[model samples]
Target: MLEVRDLVVNYGEAAALRGVDMTVRSGETVSLIGANGAGKSTLVKALMGMQPVTSGSVLLDGEDISRRQASDRPKLGMAIVPEGRRLFKDMSVKDNLRLGLHDAAARRRGADGLDLAYDLFPILRKRSRQLCGTMSGGEQQMVALGRALVSRPRLLILDEPSLGLAPIVVAQVFEVIEAVVAQDVTVLLAEQNMHRALSLSDRGYVLADGSVVLEGTGTELLQSDRVRTAYLGES
Candidate 1:
């Protein structure tokens, strides 16, 4: 469903990605795992068009989207749940979710998508009229996930989903992810928790310094010596 080939991104003279290549097949969950400064985020942002790619290509459903603006990408069925669960602090939970739907009727009435969000996370329905900022970290993350879901994306890209959350909350988030995958949404996951990421993914890619160093089925990669040493710190 998504493919990035030899993508390179530079900040002035400093290079972030040198030649990253990865692909996510339809109806599959793929994880990208790497340490800090490995250019995982850079590769994702390049695909999202938040950061420009100096060279190479990004393909969505077999079409080149390398130069497309971030705003334009969403309407084409690509959505991202960024590392930080960014939310409008003062907005009501329902209103925050309403911002995600692009349909004029749904965005105007907010009834259709709001119901869907409520179904995904019943907590959001209960907190519909409450300020988003006052919610707990887990609640906020739920809201972020709901917002992305309401848009009905074909390719869902998640970055560092477990960051700054308790283990229980992180597990809950992963559960929600499995639910999303069950609905046939393709996932591209970048996560620091190598174990969790690899466990959930159908396939895995190891990123090092902005390039893909290894790729294999999740179980295969998990048992590999290189993955153990580089990411899992296991013997």
Candidate 2:
């Protein structure tokens, strides 16, 4: 559903991404694994049109969207649960989720999509009237995920969904993601937790210094000697 080829991004003289190539087919989950500063976020921003691409193409469903505006992507059936779960602190939970329906189709889905969100995370329905900032980290993450899903996106991109949560909560978040995958939403996950990322993904790519260093099926990567040494901390 999504393809990025020879993608490069530069900050003045420094290149944040160089010749990165990856693909997420329809009805599949793909993971991008890398250490901090490996250009995962850069790639995400570029794909979403938040960052300008110095070169290369971002194709969605076979059309080039590289030059499209950031605000235009959501209308084209793309949504993101960004790193850090950026949310409105003072907004009620329902109000926060309602922001996802910016496009006409999403707005048309309306309360039906809201129901889907609540079904995905029942806690969100209970907290509908509560302020978002006062919620726990796990709760906030749930809100972020719900916000993305309520948009009825065809391609869902998640950045660091496991960051700064207890192990149990992280597991719960992964479970929710798996549930989403069961519904056949194409997913592109950028995560630092190599084990969890690869485990949930059908295929995975490793990025280093802004380039794709390796690519394989999740199980293949998990058992790779190079991956075991570099990312898995094993010899």
Candidate 3:
């Protein structure tokens, strides 16, 4: 459903991505796994057009969208839940979800956006009128995912939803992800936690030094010696 070819991204004199190539199929959860500074986020930023692509192409449904503006991505059925759960802290939970639906056309197609989002995170429904900043970390992450879902995106790009949460909460978030995939929304997951990510994804790509070092089915990577030491921390 999405294709990124030889994507290169730079920040002034520094290169964040170098000739990176990746793809995510419809109904598949593809993961980009790497340590910090590996350029996984840079690849995402470039795809969303938040970061400029020095050279390469990003395609959505066979159409080149490498140069499109970030603001246009949401209308094209693409949305990202950034790493930090960047919610409008002072705003009510309902308003945060409303921000996800950017286009009038998309909004008109659905009156149940809030209902569906709340259903995805029952906790959000219970706390819909509360200030986002006052919620616990897990609750805040739920709000983030709920907000993203309100957009009715065909492809949801989530950057580290499990960051800084308890293991149980992380598992809960992944359960939501698995359920979302069942609803047929394609997912691109960028995660630092290799085991959690690989378990959830059908396929994955490992990046190092701003380039793709490996790509394989999740099970394959999990069992490989290279990934075991470098990522999985196994013997």
Candidate 4:
């Protein structure tokens, strides 16, 4: 459903991503796993059109969208739960989620979209009117996930969804992700939690220093000596 070819991105003279390539097939979950500075976020930003691609092509269903504006991405069946759960802290949960409907088609189904989000995380329904900043970290993360899911995107990108939550909360989040996968939404997960991410993904990519170092099925990656040593800390 999504393809990235020879992608490159730079900040001034420093290259943040260099000649990277990736693909996400429709109706499957794919993981991009790496360390803190391994350019995972850079790749996410590049895919979402948030960071300028120095040179590369981003294709969605064979259409080149590399130069498309970020504002237009949501309309192109793309949505992201960005790293850090970037939310409108001062806004009500419902209002914050409303921001995800950036196009007329999504807005037309806004009511149904919201219903689905609330159904996925029932706590959100009870806290719909609460200010996002007053919510706990786990609750706030729920809002972030809801905001993205409310758009009913075909391709969902989750960047560091487990960053600051407690272990139990992280498990809940991944359970929700599992449910999402069951719904046939293609997912591209950029996470540092290697085990959880790879375990849930159908395919996985290991990024290091702005390039893909390993690509394989999820179980294959989890059993790899290199992945165990580098990310899983099994060595």
lDDT of every predicted structure (CA atoms)? 0.85, 0.91, 0.86, 0.91
Per-prediction TM-score, please?
A: 0.93, 0.96, 0.95, 0.96
Clashes of each: 0, 0, 0, 0
Q: Taking the tens digit of each residue's C-alpha lDDT, what string does model 3 give over 164-219?
A: 88888888778877777777788999998888889878999999989999999998
Ordered from best to worst TM-score, the candidate numbers read 2, 4, 3, 1
Error of 2 at 185 (Å): 1.2
Q: For model 1, what is the alpha-carbon lDDT of residue 120?
A: 76
Per-residue alpha-carbon lDDT of candidate 4 for residues 62-94, written as tens digits (9 for 90 to 100): 999999999888888899999899899999999
lDDT of 1 by residue, 62-104 (tens): 8999999988877787778998978898999988887788655
Off by over 4 Å in 1: 102-111
| TM-score: model 4 vs. ground truth | 0.96
On the 0 to 100 scale, the lDDT of residue 150 in model 1 is: 83
> Residue 180, candidate 1: how far off, in angstroms?
1.7
Consecutive 10-residue window with the lowest summed lDDT within model 2: 102-111
Model 2 per-residue lDDT tens digits across residues 1-235? 8999899899999999999899999888999998989999999999999999999999999999999999989888899999999999899999989988877877765547889899989989998999999998778888998999997889999999888888988888888888888878899999988998899899999999999999999999999999989988989
